[model samples]
Target chain A: MTIWQRLRHTLRHGPAPLPAAAPSAETAAALAARLDAAAQRRLGRSLAIRHVGAGGCDGCELELRALNGIVYDLERFGLRFVTSPRHADILLATGPLTRTMAEALARTHAAMGEPKWVVAVGDCAIDGGVFKGSYACLGGITTLPVDLVIRGCPPTPWQVLEGLRALIEANATPAR
Target chain B: MSAAAAIIRAGAASGQRPWPRHALSRERWQAMAAALDAADAPSLQGVWAEAERVHALFLDAGSPLAASVEVDGGSYPALSPHCPAASWFERMIHDLFGHTAEGGRDARGWLDHGAWATAAPLGPRQAALPPRVGAPEPPEFLPVEGEDLNQIGLGPVAGAIAEPAHLRLTAQGETLVRLEVRLGYAHKGTLGLMRGTPPRAAARFAARLSGSATVAHGLAYAHAVEAALGVAPPPRAVALRAVMAELERIRAHLDAAAAILAEAGAAFLETRFGWHREAMHEAAGRAFGHRLMMDAVAPGGLATDLAADGAAAIRAALAALAAELPDLVRRLDRSASLGAGIGRIAPDLALRFGASGPVGRASRRASGHGGDARLVPGYPPYPVLGLDVPTRAEGDVAARLRVRLDELPESARLLRALLEALPDGTIATALPAASGEGLGVAESSRGTVWHWVRIEGGLVAAAFARDPDWLHWPLLEAAMRNGMLADLPLCAASFGLTSSGVDL
Candidate 1:
């Protein structure tokens, strides 16, 4: 294709956006159970998340980065991965909890304001996937309450976005 | 004596070219270092220590044979001062196994941050240490003395999307005086986890060692086990392994290019490249079960054979990537501003640091060794198909980016060749129960990935998978010296080094 044609094509017909992944029924019900009308009013549409790599291979991190790519376009869903945990409403973490990074992860979670939710974004974060009982890692953090777990070797971008949407939608409902 | 001749004289065996082992006293080992340094193409493959012996492996640039030197006892003379490439390996051996390199420079911990449940988790006496308690103090950074220098600590946690690494940059004004990288925040004790497990079952640990280089690690581990067991995979299995490996290379390079473009402030190019990468992942997902091709290249062969439809889908994806790649390259090359912020690494620095893959290749130095196992004697298919190794003399971020871009076509060509020549045979061979040691090497996206496995009573007694990052990360430090502090991230992105790969 010619440069002009390529430019025109990009300008006129942008790349296709990723289709939303439908979350499981169980996930939807769990979100509904946790959130209520009062919670919905308190938490608005937007969720600022701070992501932590406690101790992970870059698989989940790459998938997490992909969530913000042109294809996934997570910004369109009012879910932005913020730089600071203090401004975040959700702490999205990947990797098993390694002792070296444990304090950092705790500090990050502690920095987030109250009413914050934590979403474990891969099998490593849910429970140590391959590095389960190794001397170096403690699997995922159990000290803090976890709100949701997205499971995959490195969960796809859609799974991450879909999980975030569920968390945000839970904020849209009233807590019991 | 020539390194090859030394190996031959030491009784190197035929089949996978077993490393000729020569046990030497500390004095002799130190003396051999001088001889290796005086050689035209001196190189250090890796330095590792077991319970009773510390070993060093060396390979010359053009030689087919590898020499292993064993130094009995807890300490061995350091090779880093003379060879330079053994710096991190010695540090790692000290931390992991408590084997001190008597004269080694840089005694600081490479992968230990002192927060382990027990010190020297891989050492023989690790079980005797009382369990660790309470959060340990943060790692101490080695000080760079200067009147006006101030340090900028960038991460263990920085931006939300960033990996876990601590970069201590001592700078005078905006110019970097020295950059010391403290990694190991992502350590999972993968090597320790492989102990006592059969090689086939333990293959999962290798696959997960570095998520991005899963196929390369898998192939390396598989090859190690195969070599140890004296089993050769079927021809079709080899072709399938090549197919998966090439697909991985395609995705990895695309990801690296996209990251470099993003760091260069070319968001358009980043997004376009990212789109292409995702499309490739989608294609890979259809062909293999996972987008990253994780565990697809299993021991003996693949986890499963590719169906005719899977082959067609993979072919279609490669065709699309091949068609669009040239235009992408043209646009990237046309951008004069893109190369402006790249921190320059000298060829000698790359050589001294034992840089591999694109990072080493960009330097265009004799030290930039293209140690692809496929090209190694007795390694099949690659020699038969013919492969091109690309290199450049710039040793800057742009050169590294160019190398990555240049490699895309080669990966595509390999993919096509492998697909066309897909042989008819079973996809896997049953592994033999054995007790022996073997070495595996494969050309990963970044560079040569090496795995050494020792099987005892049908189980892996000891295993080590060395990522290319072990060689590349030090080069990052040298590249950052005398560079603007702001350009460090761009330079890092171009190198595409991973903490998990090295931390393990």
Candidate 2:
């Protein structure tokens, strides 16, 4: 199990294959259908997302990590999380919006180009979830206009992927 | 004896027994802090405020006993001047409760960002007011000295999959001179929200305090409440709690390994470790109902039970992990290029911060402060089965990584022991809504996590949960001193400090 052995094994086996747990063709097409004709034309097939953790408990962060792993492999669906909001078509936000992060969230969303969409990703983001009346949190992201809401204390990776696919379809270019 | 233990012995030697509600004059409180610093107690556990007084909680690394000192007023002389370990705790007390540590060194806001509706949100009659009055002023950070040092602020919004923390690094060329971490971006008013809520419901806030260590926090919160009510969970519940806790520990270590590997640029190894962690989560989900096992460890007992089928599945998962981990570790260790920049931490710096968990263990291996929650007296199942603790003396990134790898098999062994001897009985006991105070401690994946609670009239009056990061984060600055800037990520990842854990 040494590095030499690992290199040997890599030489013998080659690189690992792309993950097999991709979204079904029907699911992809349906997601594409959700996009309006004009929006879809503008966005095309690829979607870049910028994630902002407003004031979360870290459950959603863990789930988001899972989506990138081999089990979910979110990149296969033409969706990728970019580091900068300017490079993103969607802002995928998690957590109850703490007042401290409200300005930052707004700035991030504002940085996204025109036709940018904001998707609230967890129960906390959709409303307040358990953190609902805390003085620290403003419940959801009240500072920005939100387009999509995905609810769960922390939605599972599959659920997160489904939400992403839906966002793509909703903004996808319509067929002729 | 260790310095901390000696301090406790000497402090208590006068024979005036200091109980839970031990009152001290301002002078006595200041003198005690100075004495403990001179005697070298590990860290101040927490500093909190009640109706009209401020209290400081202290723990000796070598003993289970906790000492509390109360001074009547909104301010007391700060302990940070002599004992650097109490620095953040004092600032936090000032921020949250408006209690001043009169002569504390750091005056920066530890939790408050001026975004709140009011100053001192937890101060007398302040909770009812909204936390936002107008626009918040930008937070201030201390500037690093020297003309050569250039500052870089990393986050509050990071690239991906990270809790919100502003890591302000002061580097001279490519060498780091200082690392100042600003948290509270994820502070959800957890303690404030817990007040007035019944223990059963307030337990969720504890679990959510840091999702990665949910079971430990949940169990600790439960223990605090049970202690206050003067009740012990049924034997079956205690055993079941142990199962969930151990499983959590295993999963967290796997995740930490994956993070460390990713930082080391071992892409394939990182993914493999992450996959292993995912398998553990899947098994946990099948057995319990949540991936993080959230809400499963509730006050008084478990929220659910582990069925026979679930037990078998968990056993199979552990077997798979046990079989796959060694090969992975051996491959990771033998990679020569990855060994060059593994960060190094000094034992004295770690001791000064009262570091715990893997970070502390790797610093001074023979120190025997392993952050074992099972070490706390009166905890069941663990004492009988015993703990298989691991330590590495190098105090470098590689040493910390090795400590985690060593723990994987040890945790697996603990899980197997618990599963084989599954106790049969009621999984939960009803807790009465009563008034009292208690401290609950648990060894989470990160390290020893403690929750202190005071319940009154069937509602939580006050609560404090300490993440081991409180000790480790300060030490990180020292660890990074004069080290290459490129090694910062790996060093931070190796420590596995959490923002929400401390920010809360």
Model 2 lDDT vs. the true structure?
0.78
Best by DockQ: 1
Worst 10 residues of 1 chain B by lDDT: B8-17
Query: Which stretches of candidate 2 lie above 4 Å from their native place?
Result: A1-41, A173-176, B1-21, B39-42, B68-73, B125-134, B336-341, B365-368, B376-378
Best by lDDT: 1
Residue B24 in model 2: lDDT: 56
Query: For model 1, what is the C-alpha lDDT against the true structure?
Result: 0.78
Residue A96 of candidate 1: its Cα lDDT?
88
lDDT of 1 by residue, B112-211 (tens): 8878867778887677768777766567778677698898887788866877988888999999889988888998998899999988889988998888
TM-score of model number 2: 0.92
Task: Place model 2 in a CAPRI quality band.
Answer: medium
- Compared with the true structure, all predictions reach lDDT values of 0.78, 0.78
Best by TM-score: 1
